[model samples]
Target: MTSTAEEEVLIGFGTTCYYLVFRLMITTTGYGLAALGSLIVIRTINLDNAKSWREPKSIQLLCSLIILSCFTGYIILQAAHAFIAIKAGIGGNPVSLAMLLTDDIQLFLNATIILVGDFVICWRAWVLLSEDKFWRYFLALAMIINIGINIADPVYDVPNMKSELKGVFNVLDWLSVACSSIVNLIATSLIAWKAWSHYRLSRETSIWRVGRQSHRARWVLLLIIESGALFLVLQLFALATETGSSFSGSTFDKDLTFVTVAKVAGSLWNVSAALYPLAIIILVHTNNSPIEETYYAGTQHTPVSLTLLGNMRHSASGGGESTAF
Candidate 1:
C-alpha cells in the first residue's frame, strides 16, 4: 500500500471492504448532518401561548422529523447489509440466502427513501402551483405512477436478484428514475416561472411598496430556492453517480473511476435527501418561504396594487375608519 512502484494486492471483491466502509460512512455522517438540520427545524417550532400544534411551523417540524426517521431506517438497513458483507468477506465465505434477503430489504428501503424525498419535492411544487389545475393534475398523475414504480421495483428486485430477470428490473429502475427526474424538472421550471412572474408582478404592482425595493430581488431569489430548486442541484450530482452505477454495479477494478464517482456522489446524496425538506424548513423559519397564508398571493387571482397602499393615508385624512390589516 506504499507509494513505491510495487504490485498492489486486491481485496476479495469490490462489494466487500469498499462498499462496507461507504455504507458506514454514509449512514454515520449523513444521519449526523441530517439530525443537526432537524435540530434547526425543531428550533423553528413555537411554544406559543396562543397557537395550536397544527400551525405551519409545527407542521414543518413534523415533516422534518418524519423524514429523518425514514432516513434512519434506510441507513440501518444499509449498515446491516454492509456489516453482513464485511463478515462474509473476512471469513472467506459466500453470503447466505438470509443475507441476500437482507439485501432485498435494503433495496426496498432505497426505493422508499427516494419516493419520500421526491414526494416532498413534489409537494412543494403542489403548494406553489396551487391555483394551476393543469400542473396540479399533471404532478398528481406523475407521482401516482412514481409511487407505483417504487412499489413494483422492490417486488421485482427480490426475485430478479437471483434470476435472469435483472434486465426487466433495470428497465423498471430506469423508468422510475426517469419519471422522478421529469417530475423534478417540471417542479423546478414551475418554481422558476412562478418566481419570475412574481417578480414582475411585484414591480408592476408595488413601485413604492411597503418593503424595501432592493429586498424584492432577494425575496424572488429566495422564492425559487425555498421552493425546492436547491434539491435539483444535489439531484444532478446524484444522477451522475447513479449513471455511473448503472454502467458498472459493484465493480472497482474494471471501472474504478466510475465506481468511485458513484460511491462518493451517493454518499453526498444521503445527506442531500434529508436536506430537501430541511432546506424548506430552514427557509420557512427564516421567513424566506413564500407567504404561507396564500400561494402565488400577488401574482394571480388577486393582484396586489400599491396605488391604494401609497395613497391610503392621504385618503384617510378625512378620518373615516381604515379597513386594511
Candidate 2:
C-alpha cells in the first residue's frame, strides 16, 4: 500500500478522531439494531418454542436464531476491534489480521451473514411470487449465482486481504456489492410486479372501491416497501462505497477519510443485511401482517398473493393462491 494509506491504518486513535467517530457511530447504529434484533429473536423463540419441528414456523425460528447469533457476534467483534485498536494506538491495524484475530473471525461471520441473508431474501421472494413459475425459476437461478459470488469472493479476497491489505477490497468488494444489487433488484422487481398485478385485480374486482382512491395505491406501495426496498437502498450505498473508494486503483481520500468511509460502509452493510430478516420476523411475530389484516380486514376479497408480510397460513383452493414459500 501507499505510505499515506499505511500511516492512516497504523496511526493511533487520537490522530484519527474523525475515523474513530464515524466508525463508532456506524458501530453504534449497528449495535443498537443488533440488540433490537436479538430481542426480536428471543421473543419469537419464546413465543413459538412449543412449535413442532415439522411446523413451518420452525423454519423461521431456526433462521432467526442462526442469523441473530452470527449478527451479535459480528457486531460485538467489531466493537471490540475498535476498542482494541484504540488501546493499541500506533500499533493498530484492525483491518488486518496482523493487528488481531478479529479480522479473521469477522470474515467468517460476514460471509455467513451475507450468505444466509441473501438466501432468506430470495426465499421470501420465491414464496411471495408463488403463481409465477418462470420468475420463481429465474429467482432461484439468480440466488444460485448469488450464493456462488458470496462464497467465492471471500475465499479469493482472504489471501489478498492479509497481504497488501488496504481499507477496501477494491475491485472485489465492489463486485460483490454489485452482484448483491443485481440479485435484490430482481427480487424486488418480481415483488413489485406481483403487487401491481394483484392491486389491479382488486381494483377491477371492486374490492378497492370500498375505500378512498389512494387505498389501492397505498396498498401496492406498502407491499413494495416491505419486500426488500430498504435493504436494496442499503446495498446501493454499500456498492457506491466500494466503487467510490478506489475505482481507478487508488484511494479516493489520502487521509483518514478513506478508512472512515470504508469502515462505515462495511458496518452499514452488515447491520442492514441482518436487520432485513429481523424486521420481517418482528412484523410477523408481533402484528402478523398489519397491512393484510388492516386493508383486507372486512373485505371478503383478499389479494391472491398477499404473502409480503408472510401471512400465508395455509394453501386454500384457488387459481392464484399458491404457498410456495
Displacement of the residue 147 alpha carbon in candidate 2, Å: 1.6
Backbone steric clashes in candidate 2, count: 0
Worst lDDT window (10 residues) for model 1? 296-305
lDDT of all predictions: 0.64, 0.63
Pairs in clash, predicted candidate 2? none
| Model 2 per-residue lDDT at 158 | 64
By lDDT, the best candidate is 1
> How big is the positional error of residue 318 in model 2, measured in Å on the Cα after superposition?
19
Residue-by-residue lDDT tens digits, candidate 2, 97-201: 444477667777887877777776676666566567998898888778877877777777667645654454456567777887888889877766655665555
Give per-residue CA lDDT, model 1, range 1-325, as digits (tens). Answer: 4543322323434545786787578678878878888888777656453266654455556678777877778678777777777677556565767578887876776676677677766766776675699999998898888889878878877886676432232666556666666777787787677666655554554433457475767766676666656666666766656754554334532576766776776667656767766776677555566533233222234322233333444444554433332
List the candidates' TM-scores in order: 0.74, 0.73
Give the TM-score (vs. native) of candidate 1: 0.74
TM-score of 2: 0.73
